[model samples]
Target chain A: MELVVVSVLGADRVGIVAGIASVLARHNANIVDISQTVVRDIFSMIMVVDISKADVDISQLRRELEEEGKRLGVMVGVFHIDVFKYMQRI
Target chain B: MRFDPREIGEVLEMLVFRELDIRAVTLSVNTLPAIRPNLKDALDALSHLLEPYARRLRPAAEKVASKLGVRIVTVRLAVSPTSIMLEPLGDAKAAVEIAAFLDELAGRHGVDMVGGFSAFVHGGVSRGAAALIEGLAEALNSTERVAGFLNAASTMTGINLEAVRRAARIVLSLKPHAAARFAVTANLPEDVPFMPGAYHGLGQPDAVVNIAVSGPGVIEAVVRSLPDADVRTLHDAIKRAAFKITRLGELVGREVAKELGVAFGAVDLSVAPSPKVGDSVAAVLEAMGLPRVGAPGSVFALALFTDAVKKGGAMAASTIGGLSGAFIPVSEDAVMSQAAAEGAITLDGLKAMAAVCNTGLDMVGIPADVGPDVVAAIIADVMALAVHLDKPLGVRLIPVPGARPGDIYDLGGLYGRVAVVDASRYSKIPLVARPGTAPPGVERLKKG
Candidate 1:
């Protein structure tokens, strides 16, 4: 499976998760795990997704997520899971 | 699979806030095999061999950067020492032509710079080395995308004072900014991704990929996170940060090499800093509790930090080459430049720091009146230190024309601004005039 980690950070607001989830659903990406937290009104969400079945490639998915994030007033980043594995696991 | 939010946040913080990124990914191409009896044939052979790789480097680097969500700064190319290619032709004019052609090729292919317009005269000079040296002033002065190096000292071969003199003269003759593109090295490593010291050594493969990681900001952030931690704790924290940083470089390097269909070489774990805010190595030292970079305990602080970086890099990557330590290039780092401007760091103090760091007195500006003998003496002193420590070190200086001590020469952009440091006190070392290689250091006896 093509695993990826999607992160969104910004000022806390409504529809942050729903906005991201809708994009992922439209692309047929499966969110396997998610953890989120808020501190001093700043919101951060991390999601691990399997993009193997997604119609869009990683770059295209990133652009779409980023555009959605901009509409929601947030910063979004999508990275191949191997980066986390290399930097954090080892 | 378990995912820790804090771990994810830490990686993001390192990237977004600390400015952690890969500074350089250099493709070291072997061009010596392309040399022919005539300069035209040699140029044709080199163009045929190098064009495709240059065309592919930037795209491959950008792809990896996008995939990993990492910022890859500069893509560079290093050729096998052009002096060797000039050996058969035995023409100084050919050296300049090759440098210009490489410069044009690099620009055409979007490569930032092409290095290894070099002469390795650590022990003595050869006919080709002589030709290259004769034309170095013109080649470097004329080309914007070509970088040059002269390895004039080594532990095994000793110091060549004559070569040092010649290198200093070349420095004196270069245009104000062109000196930034030149370096005189002692025991320069082969696979360094950073110019102007990088060159594809004789021992390297035909084509390979090497990487340089930059993370002074990350290290400083780590140091600041532990406000009350002891020295050992700071060391551990820095080491951990370096491990993560090197891993990123290793991953990017291997992936880029795979994309380009070349061998994955090594990760150079130099904590490179830029003039940008929050990206200063001196700031890391200050975060570790030194009041300033050249403070009394500066040497100890540098030693501790450099050793921990190497330790962390060792654990992170299986194959490590190049100068695997911190680089304290004066003009390129804001805090370093400020310290120099404030008289907090002198050229002598920088020399002391280099005993523990990688390159010696790099990117420093000196007065134009210091003379070649004085500059050569400075280079000689760094070589002496490298021989004693038996490690690689180098010197790259800019003698700003018509500038005086305490005057700042604003080189602008990555070159930054530099404060002219006094080299007059040591200005009259007669030892530089003697034209022979100093005997090899006692450190070489270890091999026996």
Candidate 2:
């Protein structure tokens, strides 16, 4: 299964998680882990989601998250776990 | 799948946020534009120039911090030397105005400290630079977030007695907070990209980038983990850990430079400590079995720490530089602060320690009425050490303007706190009878 990590950050408000999770759920993504924090008005979150079982393309998933991010006034990006690990291994 | 509970616990421990791993990365950018037209223009341009970088620096730093599972504590900025930048201003008051402008900009942008308000007249001094140096004690005393330095000598230009004398006067007039912000140097390297002294030389391009990585806490942690570990084993472990940490810092620094499209100047493994408990260079020394910083074996402890850190960091990165030795700032290091308070360390003792280590007389507190000649004496002693040892040494002596010995001044924030050290009660010793060329082979003393 292809694992991907998604990070989101925006001004603190409600429904941020639900909005992003709805998009992930529609893509048949399985969230293996999630963590978040709110420091005053700034909100940040990270999720490890798996999408190998689904037939959806990674680009499409990215586009969906981007659209949702814009609607919520947040920054959202998806990265392959392998790419993240390689960048960290330096 | 077979799973061991202990292995599961280890994974969970990594995920749990027990410690806040944060590093302060300062980008020393040239801000000569700020002082070009007038104090107002200087302030406006500085604020504007830094606004974009401030916005981007956090996101960029946070991106890297997230990857490393650490936090970016503060994104600080250091500018080109203030004396040269304010040369057109032409007076001490104007220099102070420019310093205030920079201080205001730093406060607005949430920067911890902004450096480079300094003069490098090691050989001779210009009239404008002299006036600025005269006002530095007051400027640093009155302002927060402003740091200063004076480079009194270089390998090319021999030490300037006049500038050194003026620096002594400034230090004597320095208040506690101001004293902590000041650094005096000999043979100041051109490539130092970090604070209180970063300036874009006329020879450099429009802008360049450098990185300073501090992990005294990490070193302390490594040392603490090895209970009953032999000296050789301890040294090897410290070196290996420093190598790994330096490699990680080099990787991040290179990436940042690549993203910014600037030259990667160098990676400084300075082991700089914070005021936070357990993250101090002094604590590292104490861990090595010194009863306190100025204890009998303090010099040996610092020497060993400095040598091992250099050995590891030099091997880890090709271009390693800066004040890369273990920082022994009293206020910044918990153990040092405690030692100073308990009279376990004296000003002379600290100077002795600096002779065998990196920073020279850093964050040391002293009385206000101390003579300029004595302050000059301290600087000269450290200069002699640097010259004799052939390594970089800096004196960040804070002469509290009104406080006397046994008095403690509380300079809040990372500047830390310091107890006043007794000033030497005797007459000053004369080192240089007259200003002349340095003897041949003096430069050879700096090898290593």
Best by DockQ: 1
DockQ (C-alpha based) per candidate is 0.83, 0.06
Model no. 1, DockQ: 0.83
Which stretches of candidate 2 lie above 4 Å from their native place? A1-90, B1-22, B32-55, B66-68, B191-194, B201-204, B258-261, B401-406, B427-441, B444-448
TM-score of each: 0.98, 0.77
Tens-digit lDDT track of model 2 for A1-90: 777767787898889999999999987999887878788889877777888875576667877898999999998766545433422333
TM-score of every candidate's chain A: 0.97, 0.92
Candidate 1 CA-lDDT value: 0.91
Model 1 bad stretches (over 4 Å): none
* lDDT by residue (tens digit), candidate 1, A1-90: 888899999999999999999999999999999999998999999999999999998888999999999999999999888888888986
lDDT of 2 by residue, B61-123 (tens): 656655443445666666777787567666788778767876877777676777778888866
Q: Report the CA-based lDDT of candidate 2 relative to the real structure.
A: 0.69
DockQ of 2: 0.06
